[model samples]
Target: MQETPFCLRVGHLLPYSMSDSNTTDFTNPSNFILIGIPGLEIAHVWISIAFCTMYAIAILGNFTILFIVKIEPSLHEPMYYFLCMLAVSDLALSTSTLPKTLSIFWFNSREIDFSACLTQMYFIHCFSAMESGIFVAMALDRYVAICDPLRHSTILTNHVVAKISLAVVLRGCVLVLPTAFLARQWPYCRTNIIPHTYCEHIAVVKLACNDTRVSSYYGLFVVFFVTGLDMLFIAVSYTQILRAIFSLPTKDTRLKTFGTCGSHLCVILAFYIPGLFSFLMQLFGHNVALHFHVLMANIYLLVPPMLNPIIYGVRTRQIRDRLLRLFPHKRI
Candidate 1:
């Protein structure tokens, strides 16, 4: 006897079911496959724990930096202004996905509402663009300090910083708006289950029922434009900075300048290395190796914020001192 599609009706609820023949049924229980390497169960658990820990550290660390900057009158300079911006961006970056990701892992629920998912995607990209813009601004700040020290203060005045901040937010919004809109236009017919813990744009786009070639192209274009071009600018700025430092006759002045840049360099490497590696691995790695790519993606998202405050505090003595003063008598 042919069963009536195995209907599982409840009181006043007509829950639909799929016949065995129907391969694509919205009514069927979501067949979300958790594909990954066999031994990654332990790895996934550890990663989840690490992610939670990093989320806390990132938030606390950035918040502390923000607080110190806000209260410390002496630290009110273009460099510190950029640092504050970066801290805010990191906070937003971590907050955009960490809570949703932690919730999914903690409760073992993969279901995210469509609206919520798109919102997360938008903010994640928005903050990401803002972070890139902030990096560019930081590089410019350093360039001025190193190459044009005589006019550094004059050039990077309060009004200029305000304008740069405004530009960062506006440009980020403009760049990411299309991607978010395009993502929502697609009808999700394939598995609603996102492979990764979060609703990443690429992962979501791959599940679209409609053709996404244009979206993919545009997404890649935006990623390259924002990340690649920004990186190029940073590289050029650092090159000039290095040239200036090397030309300095006094060793002490060179050392001090390098010390100031050390933290920014560390954070930049930490943020970009894992991210670039993940992008490359995703493009070239085999199906079985995709798990590693996913792991890299998780790390790229999680690690930078965890390290940003530590780098900045240790490198900037004023920040470190202010932090100590804030919690006087408490063992740090």
Candidate 2:
């Protein structure tokens, strides 16, 4: 009988085996679970299919949004400029995790290199921050258009829009880079199996053997500082916008103004509400809650991107007109 290889024997013990020819087993036992979710094998296949579809749609939808904004001279205003930024951010956000996630599903391999994992996490945070900033900018743009229409063009001139874009990029860099730096300092003694489909900062941080208290605190601070503050500003802006709209002499003007903002409000709520619920579920409920949290995570990340173009096209006449013009023969 031929002797069994030591590497093969070792690989059997690890949750995930290295793909390299050297055959070194880099498996951490603590990270191994017995695939605890019932019917997880079938669930994995379904999840893979679902994620692949979502990933493809996300890429295509965002790309179309970007293309429309770029080619259409009519969309050169600050609002469309910021819409393009949001599209870019959404593309980056989805791309950061979906490809790798699809690979794991198809290949039955979850062995991501340390550096690759870190890179994915960094971009995930960065693009998410960027999207939040873009939403805030959108609210501000609406405020100016409604509350200070006389100076809308002056206040949000090309130069000013460019400056705001630069500021959003800079803020994303500053806020998200620290997460990568802090994550790198910790030793990943625990199992490297990330539970979720993506390289989420919180999920990965939970696997660190070292103290992640600081990282968690920083993440919370970011969530509160960026999301919390942005939401507050958006609320105030919308409140003032509502007051202005109601005070308008013509009902048509009021309705048009509300129509313009309605889609954005819907998208914002869709993106934030599921995410917040998932976060709360994860924090409060440990066992069964995790499963629901994971499901919500997928919806939160994918649904907004999928719905954004539809929402804007359906809600805004200009966007609908452009879409129709782009496909002139197609009937609505």
Candidate 3:
């Protein structure tokens, strides 16, 4: 008989494998139970409708941006490239979490395989980190356009954008990989029911009884430190941009400058504020209602993806004009 590979054996043992009769041992919890928003059980039906709508809008909006960018030759610039990157990141982010989220609300299906939860947690953090990186790239694009218009084309060439995209992807994957490894090391010894709709790094880490501070801190680092670095760069870029905008000769020029950044700023704020709130909830939210944690995490994941396309589609003159031309008879 052929021997099972060591990796395969470990894989089988990884879930529901650890149990001590003296202590609460969930060991390898083969699956995790997701109890959707506590106390709102009866309202899940109504909530499903809303979440489904949000998911639909996010898909439609991001795909529309993709379609529009594909057809419009004039939009093949670094800025639009970054915008496309953002759209792709949003799609990944939303797709990672929302389908499972909606399933719990609609199908009454709540059990997620242990490995599946880990995969979900990894992707959720990975794409979210990519979003942060893309924002920084976008900010840099805006900075170059405003602060050094003459070299903007040369500075953010297609090759450069490709490199940036590659870097963003690598960074996200590399930083978030540790989280899953850390989770794998900690033995779970309690009820495997995760008290939320989706599996996040923090959500899963909180379940382990061991000294989980490392996993929690690493999560915080990914959530706060990585994003903070990106946000810091974005802030610096925008500060330079604002100074350049203010130095312009005319009020019209200043408004135009601000107009160029408005959509991106909106996207930034939409992504970060709820993320910060959710991060806080993970820390201090013990005092607050459990539902608030559920709500904030959903907002952090769901709201930005839903809003980014709408924000850009309306605020961007190029997208607006092309949209108008494409559907001249219909009101956008």
Candidate 4:
């Protein structure tokens, strides 16, 4: 033995580093403790307040839209159907991360079981991926409605909508399951503290004793194909949408036609911009601060879910119309 830097004594409960470095041994279950907004542990109490507010609004807003879409017959068209799917995806994404995040920030409860962490990681990525797919699907819906008005109903019928939803859900589940499975199989000999608000796949994988490049690269690949391709296709769809608008005979017609896409366009940009930035930072800026990395990651994951419902409530006419019709009007 050249020199023993960190020693794991037979009965010690905590690991300590005395100055040695070596490969880790991967065996057995390891509990991961999430560190929220790294280097700002003192401010977690305040952070939790903001997060709770976002969560409350996100869940309530999304649930409201879901309720409205479910009961209203007039809004049972394909666009609203896609919107409902979007709401479901947002709810899944938020619920997967926010509750545990609040627990970490408010109660200092961050110890996550190995299996539980794996499950959380799986859902986070899965729901996020699903959300991306839904955006693409929405863009396609708009393209059809705008570019081929007469065929829109025929194309996006109930059967077709159900198939699209199934495809979105299945795509995410199939893609993310492998990463979670491979991650769970990795040997985590030490370093179970995840430097983030939630159990993200890459963050959790870094704790493993084995070489983590495989998971990292695979994660990057999935992101490129899933989120990246979705974005590319959205861009292409919108390009066609713009052409269709310009082809309209009158200016008012063009504006009215494009207005229908505004909410979806906002949602697409909102979701993907931060995601792209976070992913890029991870790829190229290895020297970036851990706190910044964690912050960006949290913003990308949480902001869209919190904001999507609000955007739709304010922007979509059908939703707003139905919402106003929900209450009894008594002029005081």
Candidate 5:
């Protein structure tokens, strides 16, 4: 006998009426059931506790970054401007899904309206793309500051930074807008049960009855074209930065030059490594457990937002000093 489709196996979970013979289709499904993680439902409460903690940290850390950057005159430079953009993007990205995810885990409120799912999908992807673009901008700032110090200020002027910020935001919005439209057009006849915590692009597409090669391929293209291109640019920027740092006359000069890039490199790695791993696993790791895949997806979304401010606070002298000054009496 053929295996039961994943959606039908979880059909009882949906509050919607099912077809009499289990052969009818739910063309649009109107709404979807998001089962937080398959094969680990028993552990969801425990998982929610950890996820809730991370969500709180992400909120507080990113807000603190924004607050400090806004109030501190010393952090008004191009680098910190990019940092502010990063904090904003992180805030939006995490906020896009965490509340709903927590609701599913905490209250068993797993049903999401179709339109709401699409909106969540759009924001999640748009901010993700925006964050990648911001990383590219931050990389360029570091490159100019270290590799071409004299021209850094003139090149990355206030006007230029503003323009770059606008471009990043527009690029993300335009690129991800298409995916949502494409997803909306799909006929989700395969039942409305999404096996993951959130409405990920491929996961939603997988629920469609018709051919979704175009949707899948387009999503992959966006990732490879926009995100891949951004990574390429960041890699080149760091290459030049390293070469410039090594060429400095004194050891102390080299160390100082390299120090400026340390936090950025760490943040980039923290964001991209898990991102790429999850992407590849979704593509090729058919043998991998479904819960593992979903868990990795959640981790990729949560970890960077939680860690970025901490990494910057510990790695940057100015931010660290300012943070200490803010909490002078307490040991933070």
Candidate 6:
């Protein structure tokens, strides 16, 4: 029998090998192959078109929000300040994965360096946590504006907003730091083929050769502790806001109070509902098709960033007027 070629043996031991338990000892692959959507390879080119459009919209819309807030002296208040933070978070979260995902779809460039994957994973989760915190701050801003109108400015002063922004950044970075560290410590002896477009935490951990219970449980803890706790605060704030609104003597007062939160409420639902669904499906939906889960994961990140600016621009009178003003010749 002819001897096996050296290249074939190395290929079998590393990148091209498909066996899950192929490595007997602790080993780490130099890189991973992201297959994009597992069952949708035939349509990757078409999907890339849609992904490109959404990314373009997200980038343009967020930059516009940041610019408008920066230039408009009247918008230099706590509410718009929190809005700027939210816009920045959305930009960062989407950007963390969009480039690699587009590369996979457009050019079949599926290989991602191990360290790069970890960095992408860290930023994606960190910014997601930060975005949740920003939403809570925005909710509090609305609560004070409606419930304690007298002290709205005094309470959420520029000084206080600065503190809140710092807390949001620190909380996300510190909490998510451990997840990346845990992921890095794992020995990825399984097949290096990740069936998703990006290096999601759960997906990456599931490939490790050793017990991953600690990492998995810690990730769940961070999700609930950060996202769950922030959501609870938002709920309490909104409840107070509603109660304060209804106590107002006139119907017009109630309508006006609720109107102030319409954009914020829309944004909250857009960000949280799909996010929760994707998380739950990953944990419990064992029978759910893999492609469906991956698609939802991608959508959970993509849709919110694209929709947030549109929702705020359409529902917020201030942003709408400023956006309109930017184009004098195309006045409508």
lDDT winner among the candidates? 5
Candidate 6 lDDT, 51-151, residue by residue in tens = 88999999999999999888888889998999999999999999999999999988889999999999999999999999999999999899889978899
Model 4 compared with the native: what TM-score?
0.91
Please list the C-alpha lDDT of all candidates, in the order they appear: 0.76, 0.73, 0.84, 0.83, 0.88, 0.87
Candidate 3 error regions (>4 Å): 1-24, 330-332
Worst 10 residues of 6 by lDDT: 5-14
Inter-residue clash pairs, candidate 3: 15-28, 16-28, 16-29, 17-28, 18-27, 18-28, 26-189
Off by over 4 Å in 6: 1-26, 329-332
| Candidate 4, residue 176: how far the Cα is off, in Å | 0.7
Best of the two (5, 6) by TM-score: 5
**Candidate 3 vs. truth: CA RMSD?**
7.5
Which sections of candidate 2 miss by over 4 Å? Answer: 1-39, 330-332
- lDDT (C-alpha) at residue 140 in model 5: 94
Each candidate structure's TM-score, on Cα atoms with residue i matched to residue i, is: 0.86, 0.86, 0.91, 0.91, 0.93, 0.92
RMSDs, each prediction? 6.9, 6.1, 7.5, 5.0, 3.7, 5.0
| Model 5 agreement with the true structure over 1-332: per-residue lDDT tens digits | 32344452311222333344333566887788898888788899999999999989989998988998888998999999999999999999999999999999889998999999999999999999999999999999999999888999899999999999999999999999999999999787756778889999888888787788888889999999888999999999999999988888999988987888999999999999999999999878877878898999999999999999989989999998888888769558
Task: Give stretches of model 4 more than 4 Å off.
Answer: 1-26
Question: Of the candidates shown, which would achieve the greatest TM-score relative to the real structure?
Answer: 5
Candidate 2 structure quality by residue, lDDT tens digits, 215-276: 98998888888888888988999999999999999999888878888988987887788778
For candidate 1, the 10 contiguous residues with the lowest summed lDDT are 6-15
lDDT of 1 at 242: 98
